[model samples]
Target chain A: MKKSLEGRVAIVTGGGGGIGGEVSKWLAKEGAAVVVNDVGSDLSGGGFSSTPADGIVSEIIGSGGDAVANYDSVAQPDGAKRIVNAAMSMFGRLDIVCHAAGIVRDRMVFNMLEEEWDDVINVHLYGALNIVAEAVPIMKSQSYGRIILFSSVSALGNLGQCNYSAAKGGQIGIVQGLADELKVDNITINAVFPGADTRMTEGMSSTARAYIEQWGVSAESSDAQGIRSSVRNAPKVAYLCTEAAANITGQVIGVFGPPMTVYSQRVLMRKLYKSNAWQFDDLDFAIGSSLNRNIPESRLGGKYEQR
Target chain B: MGDRFRGKVALVTGEDHDLIKEISTLFASEGAAIVANCSHSEWVERMVSEINAVDGVAKVGHFDLTSMADAESLLNFTVDSFGKVDVFVSGIEIRDGGSVLDSVPEKWDEIIRPVMKNVFATTKYVSAHMRTQNSGQIVNIIRDKKIHHDISVTNSIITEAIIGFTRTTALDMEKYGVGCNAVISDHARNAALVSAYICSNLVTPGISSIFRVDEQEVSLYSVPAIERGIYSSDIFSVDELNYLVPKYLFDGEELS
Candidate 1:
């Protein structure tokens, strides 16, 4: 029996550890020649080591999968091009590019340093652009490609993660806006909000941990040995890179747990219709009484719920 | 002059010449001391002169919002010029548009650097002041002109970032009696009016919502939420998911 991706070639950025590593291994196991690219940067995207990429490549090859290691940072355009070039040089073709590279510098919006903001944006948002900029042209020329950006649930907005949320949120915009242009060329791009416990989550503050707990879904790290492991997210991510997923483009999918989640794009929830411009008193009354009925009154303002 | 903002001070920042002019003049007319900011000083100086000519107290801030020192200085100038800043309106216009495939790393820097640096730095400094003062209104207005057939990948990306920043900032500053919200106007139509309303006392604090302003109507954007889900005893195969996802999740119909 021929494997689904027997002749395919894949480039998995940040494939050294965690969810990205698992996805690289899964793709290789399914018969795709893999280029496992990792800068081996720390959680905040500083420092680099070739050991992480080399180790993952060895693991894949030992498991009877064809693989090579590429230690190029995706934060720069030149680095991104070299990553794509590695696939073409060794494997001769590129079919799948999964960008799971990311970093974090969590801070309250007020106290966030300029460097902190720049570093996070450079890694997550600019890194995505660098990879996609190089890979898309190749994919477009070949008339076949599958690209997946590892977005986060934080894109919706998380406390103390303004930079991260903004970067992740921008990824959503890329997938949404680019879906139309890429689909015609047979290249599909989507964002996966992988919910996994990893090094990223291990450093969660007590407040952040409590917030996650309040949501009733405890995150399990990809390295954990269990059915609830973050490794479970790998299969879904890998599946998106398969030829079978050609129909899916410009979609935001979440891989967290018992159920995979599908999110909708920005849509109008409610409206205040008017022919003439809104007067303060009238607009205030309409929004307060009707639009804000469901919102719980906060310490700042809004109508308190009548118990 | 109207007494709506008789004793208040407002700072306005953006690249759109007309929108900034309209907003600055409107706030000044409402009796608020104005700080009109831009990268270039000449136009802003002229706007400030016109406001002062009309007996409206106004100042010009030509510093870069992307710089921390400049951001702090801008805020300091506002305090030193007027007593303090009570309202902030950010009308930064996003002009980048192209397909993701056609975009480059430099384009990303060009488009994102200004928006992120300006918005984040300005909000950081301004919110620090507002937090101490125990009262302020911060409204970020994003303007984009959607070109038909252009993918607008960078534009959409920056827009979402701003929106997300607004919500996160709102949470951080809410307890301090500071309100943060975002207004997304595709055409810059009626942005000044809507922004003024957001700064008004009628708007409730701790309410961080995105409003899409158009020529005539204003619509509230729903927070992006999971509209559907597919649960299986185990993760389904590509074949199973390829069939079930659309039927159950994307079709806008209930699953059995």
Candidate 2:
């Protein structure tokens, strides 16, 4: 409604349903020519039909907005390039990119399979890379662009989600690296570690579900339909992708029900002793002493950490 | 350029020759009247003259950061001249010696007074002025790395103090629609003292090299070093700051 993004072109991967779909609709409503790239995969990253993408595109068009549909897997290089190309061909230029495509394979490291790791990694991390690799050149040429990558709280080392953590953590690292590198090019890159319910959470165990529910969301209500009907939390993931966030780069920000918080993952807390030779005993003593005196987590705890 | 900040006024304080010059010049070029202060009058005069030659409006104010009265005067003069204080950039860093046991009390006060206290006093006065107008942006430039020999204890304390001050001011001022944020940078090329420290004491056979002259050296510190140097222009360009400052001050709303 603000129209701050008028005349812009955006590509939202995993746009067939859930948060991605909402983000796509929001972008289109703001006057962006949106390309809803959905492969119609389930929570575990299996394929379905392209109907979901088609459905969202229809909804946008029916609401008197501009949108197109692309049924491509963000897991591959060619698929990623195709999504960017779709935006360029349909809308003529790309201004914003929201890489929200991901899958959840919850497993403890002891029982995690190689394919499980690869599947989540391929969808979230590589999918992000695929699109970014293709989009950066176009962004550089235009001298203006916004890239928003998705990280999750699980990246902070959640139980039974080693693979998910690895992928999400990698995404944060990529966001920071890209943000620092591309700021000079006028392309701002940032990561959002959102705490919202979606199709991804419905698959978690009941214990995990109960823990997340305390944060004010039900697992069942995160379905694609539930999100469309506004049954989820406030300040949806779409808010972070808007043009008003242009100045925030290389930051890991969290949003939950009207409370927006900026986190400091990269912090220099204590100055430990490091001499010409770092013996094991000396290193241990230095670390212990530093930890005892100053809690690194407590420095910026109130704003970021769970109360 | 456009008169985006035509009616706006800004103040920057520091002795880092390159940073002070670049920030003042950029603000002036964007139609914001600049009041730049340094310890030395010659540096201030030089910057003012250069800005004038480029058709930008700027005036030099010579003041030491150690004085609270001078800091208050800088804010008062800008508001008195331009009718409002819209932006503030703190670029002062005074590094002296201090460690846990060997640090002298005098040195501690000297180092903390200029870098951290100056910012606190300046923010106190400016936020008071901006609370009336209900809009302002404060960008505090901070060194991400601590340069201390035996002075590691005090260095960490001072660095953390600045960040705490910035965050506290941000939250307190948010109600009045004022925003304060810190820009963290690794050792900058223009910081002559930092450069000397890295070159002299840190250069050794086994010690991991801490500083790199080339832009690519940023990769060594973190994964994201796309280029070298820590100047405002290299880290965040004028256009980017223009976009960010307004966004932070207005909280994602469109600024007129």
Candidate 3:
């Protein structure tokens, strides 16, 4: 009997540690040849080391799995190209790309410097673009591919993660935006909002911690539940990259706990119409009377304290 | 009847499209001072003159869609001219067309940088100013009508990203009394009206939402919810999901 991914090849960006590292091991355990790409940047995305990627590759190889280490930064287009090339040269074909590389620059929107915003956006959002841009052609040629962008619950919005949110949020858009187009070639693109305890999240502020608590496991770990562990996120992510999950595309899945969740694609919730241009007073009255039902409570700003 | 924007100042930026022109004019007609920003100086100046001719305060500000410095200056130009900015309307047309597999990395940059990247810069600056005033509305008009099969996947991705960015900005700014929303429309008048309505006092500033405008109808995009879930103590493998998902999620119907 053969493993599920016996002949498949996968590129796991940021596979050096945490969820990405765990995911790399999982894919390898299933018999895929894995390219473990990591810059091994610190929590704030500064400094670099190759040890993370090398360590993960060593572990996989030692466990009777085929894997190679690639120290390429996904934030750059050329780096993404080299990362893909490394996979092809070592494994001959590329079939799966799990982009889990990320960094955080948490700060109040007002206090956030341009560099802070740029750094986070570059690593997370631009990095997603680079990797997918390189891998899509091979997948298209083969008529099969599975791409998973490791977005976060924070993409919806965190009190001090406007930059990170915007980047992760952009990734979700990429998944949805590319879904129909990719579906034509039997390729699938989806987002995974993983709630796990990782080094990237260890330094969260008190307000951010509280925000995560209120939002529950859908956003991050429900620490008390003890079920939404970091490694638990791997199965769902690995599953999405499999042939069994072929029909699922453009979906945003949250893997944090005992029960994995599929989020609804955004749609029209309520509408107000006017034959003529809507006046301020009239539009207000219409929304106030009808559209206000089930309006999402403000999650940030001063509303954060209301909890 | 048109005093909905009385005493307000608006910064309208985007293409030389009729939608951008109409939004500038409509806001001016509703008694708001207008800063019409576009790369085409002659076209925006013409619109500015048209608004000024109608006894509405209007000014022309230049912006290069891909330039962050230009974004900052555009906001500054609005404030310097009008004392303070009350509303910002961004209307950008998506560029390039091709499947992601066919396009190169530079193509992705070309498609994303001008629209989404610039929007991020403008939003960051405009919201910062809005936070101080404790009042403002932002309406991003992404012309999704032309986004079809031939359009690049990068284009679609950026479109979705802008929408997501809109939601995040709305959330981040709501506490400061700033409303951020995206408008998807091909119709000039409808998009203009929706932008005006969202900027109006009636819609609370803290509500970050997406609105689609077609003809006379304005519909709001809903926040995504959990469609369904199955509980378990441990994570399920592919085989287990193959069994349980069909039984529970699809009522025994196979996923096609």
DockQ for model 3?
0.46
TM-score of chain B of each: 0.90, 0.68, 0.91
Candidate 2 residues A77-192, lDDT tens each? 78887899999998889988888888887753323455775687678766776788788889889988888887665544344564565567556655654564577777877776
Report how far off residue A135 is in candidate 3 (Å): 1.8
TM-score of each: 0.91, 0.52, 0.90
User: Which lDDT tens digits does candidate 3 get at residues A203-231?
Assistant: 65443454344334444434565564677
Best by TM-score: 1
Per-residue C-alpha lDDT of model 3 across residues B1-256, encoded as one tens digit per residue: 3888899998888873687788998898899999887888888888788888889999988777466688788888889888898898988677655665566667766776667667777877888899999988888887764332344566666666676567667767767888777788768877887678767744465456666777666676665555666667766775676566656744554332
Q: For this target, which candidate reaches the highest DockQ against the unseen true structure?
A: 1
What stretches of model 2 exceed 4 Å from their correct place? Answer: A203-244, A274-276, A292-306, B1-256
C-alpha lDDT of all candidate models, in order: 0.79, 0.59, 0.77
Query: What are the per-model DockQ values?
Result: 0.53, 0.01, 0.46
Least accurate 10 contiguous residues by lDDT in model 1 chain A: A298-307
Prediction 1 global C-alpha lDDT? 0.79
Off by over 4 Å in 1: A205-216, A219-228, A295-307, B145-151, B187-189, B202-206, B233-240, B252-256
DockQ comparison, 1 vs 2, better candidate:
1
lDDT per residue (tens digit) for residues B194-224 in model 2: 2222222221211111221122122112111
